[model samples]
Target: MAATEITLEVARYRPGVDSEPVLQSYQVPLREHWAILDGLTYVKDHLDGTLSFRWSCRMGICGSCGMTVNGEPQLSCATFLTDYAPGPIRVEPLHNFPVVRDLVVDIDDFMTKLPKVKPWVIREVQSPIEEGEYLQTPEEMDECQQFSMCINCMLCYSACPVYSLEPDFLGPAAIALAQRYNLDSRDEGADERRDVLSSPEGIWACTFVGECSAVCPKGVDPAGAIQRYKLTAATQSIKELLMPRSLIPRSKG
Candidate 1:
C-alpha cells in the first residue's frame, strides 16, 4: 500500500516581515476522510509552526474554520480534501476583509457592521415574561427562519463584489441579519431600520450581483432578503405620498 500524498498551497504574509503575501506549498500524506483543517494541522505540526489560521469547532458550528479554498469561501472543517482532490489545493484568508496575518483577518469591521444592524428583535409591545415564550405560528416563524440559520461565517461578505468594490456597502451578512429581525412577527422595528438601511451606507449600495446567496454555507439568501427590503422600502415611499398616516389605507397598514 502507498500513502496518499496531497499538496497544499497556502497564502503567507507578515507585516514588516514579508515584502508581499506569497503562496507557500506543503506536501503531506492524507487519510480517506480527512478534512481540509486536518491538512492544515498536519502542515503546522510537521512542516511549519509559523503558519497562522483560525479554527475552533472541528465540526461546522462555530464557523471559525472559514477561509477561501481555491477562490471559494468555505469551512475548512466541512470541506473534505477528497472532495477537491487532484493534486494541489489553494488556501487563503477570507476575502472582503483586511488581512491581519497569513490566514487571519481583522474581524472588527465585520463585528462593528453587524451590531450597527441591530441583529436582535426590537418589539414595540413588551409582553410579560410570565406569559410564556413569545408566541409565533409556524408560518410567522417561517418568514424569517432562513435568516436565523446564518452562522456568521461571513462567506456571504467575502463573496459579495459590493463589499470588495465599496467597503461601506453595509455588505450581505449585516443586511441579512437586519432582515432576520425585521421579518420576525414579534418585531415592530422594521420601519425604524428602513431609515438606516436606506442610507448610502446600506442596502442601496448593493448592485445585485447575487453572489452572496451562492456562497452562503447555511443556505441564507441574503441577496433575496435585501431585494425584498428594497421592494418594501420603495412601496412605502409610494404609499406615503398617496395616503396620509391618519387615514387607514389597508395595503399600507
Candidate 2:
C-alpha cells in the first residue's frame, strides 16, 4: 500500500451562499500512523483554508474532532487515515446538527439543552469552611464514574436517530449527564429532576437505537444510562402513586 497520497472528499458549505452542502476533494499525504485530523489539517493548511472543523488535544481526550467519517460517527484524531485509504474518504461534520460552515456544526443547541438537565451534584447542605472534600468509596464512584467521561463532542447526538427525527429529544450526552447526577450520592434533586426526564422531549423519544453507545470514543454507554434512568423514573412513578410520601425527595435536614 502506498504511504502517501489519499483523496479526502470533504463536504463544503458556505451558509448564506449555498443552498446545501457539496463535496470538494483534496489530496493529502497520509502515513499509516497519521490520524484523519492530520489529513484535514494538511488540506486546510495547503489547499482549502476555508474548510472548517474542530480539534483540540490531538489526543482522543478532547472529543472536539468528532465527525462522520464515511457516514459513521468517529473522532478524527482516533481514526487513522490509512485505515480507509485506497483512495477517497468521505468526511463531514456530525449529522443531526446545523452546519455553521463547511464541516463545522453549531453545538449551541446541545449547550442550551445541557443546563436544563441540571448536570451537577446538588449537595443536601453546604459544608463548613473547615470541611475539605466529599469522599466516596470506590464502589460509590464506580457506580456512575464511567458516565463522566463524555467530552460533550455531540457524536452521540449525531449518531442518534431519535435526536435527528425529533429535534427536541434530550439526547445521549445530556441524558448521560443527568444519570451522572442521579447516581451521585451527594445529589438530592431526584424528584425535581423528573420534570425534564418525563417530558415529551425527554426519555420517551429514544427508541434504543444504541448508535450513541457504539460511536462513543470514551466507551460511555449513554444507552445504558438512559435505560437505567427510565427504570429509576418508572420506579419513582410507581412509588409516588402508591406511597405518596416517596414522591418528594428526602430532605437533608
Candidate 3:
C-alpha cells in the first residue's frame, strides 16, 4: 500500500517582487488527522523558508490562521486536509482586505472598526471597589454569550459581501460584538454606541446576504445580531415619532 499524498496550491505575494498573487504548489504527506495548517507547516519547515502566514494556538481559538480554502474563508487549523483529499487544495489570503504578504491579509480595517463598537462593558460611572463585582442573571448572560465567542479571526469580515462592496460598512463582527455588550445587563454604554451602530455605514449598510454567519467558525451569527438591532432601532424610531422627547431615553454620544 502507498501513503496518501496531497498537493496544496498556496497563493504567494511578495510586496515589491511580485506584481500580483500567484499560486505556488507543494506536495505533502496526507494523514487523516492533519489539517491545512499542518500542510502549510510542512511546506515552511521542509520545503520553503520564505513562505509567510499567520497562526497561533492551532486549536481554532486564536483565529489568526484564517484564510480562503477552496475559495471559502476558514480557520486553517480547523479545516482538515482529508476533506479535500485526492488532489490539489487551493489556499489563499482572506478577501475584502489588503494582502500584507503571502496568505496574510491585513486586519487594520477590523481593528479600526472594532474599537468603535466598544466590545466591552461600559458604565456611566465605575463601581467602587468595595461594591464588589456587578452581577447578572443567567438569562442576561445567555443573551450575549453566543456573540462573545467571536475569536476576531476576520473570517466573518472576509465572508461579508457588503464589506467587499462597501469598505466603509461597519461590518458583521463589530456590530455583533456591539450587540453583545449592549445586551449585557451590566453595560450602560448602549446609548454611547448607538450613533456608531445606527449610522449609515453601520447596520443599515448590511444587506443581510448572511455570508458572515455562514463562514463563522465559532457559530456566532453576526447577521442575526444585525437584523435584531435593525428591528430594535426601527421600533425606537416609531416611539420617538409618537412620544415626547422627555419620555424617551435619548441615545447620547
lDDT of 1 by residue, 1-253 (tens): 5448888999998978987679999987767788889999999999999999999988888978889999899988988888777758999999988888999988888888888877887777888889978889999899899988998888888898889988778888888888998888878777667777888889889888999999888899999988988887778778788889667332210
Model 2: worst 10 consecutive residues (lDDT sum): 244-253
lDDT of 1: 0.85
- Which candidate number maximizes lDDT? 3
Candidate 3, pairs of clashing residues: none
lDDT of 2 by residue, 48-142 (tens): 88888889899988778888999999999999988996868999989999999988898989999999989987766879869978778898788
Candidate 1, residue 164: lDDT: 90
- Estimate the TM-score of every prediction: 0.93, 0.94, 0.96
RMSD per model, one decimal = 2.1, 2.3, 1.9
Which 10-residue window of candidate 1 scores lowest in summed lDDT?
A: 244-253
Off by over 4 Å in 3: 1-3, 249-253
> How far out, in Å, is residue 93 in model 2?
1.2
Ranking by TM-score: 3, 2, 1
lDDT of 2: 0.86
Error of 2 at 238 (Å): 1.3
TM-score of 1: 0.93
Which of 1 and 2 is the better model by TM-score?
Answer: 2
Q: What's the C-alpha lDDT at position 152 in model 2?
A: 90
lDDT of 3: 0.91
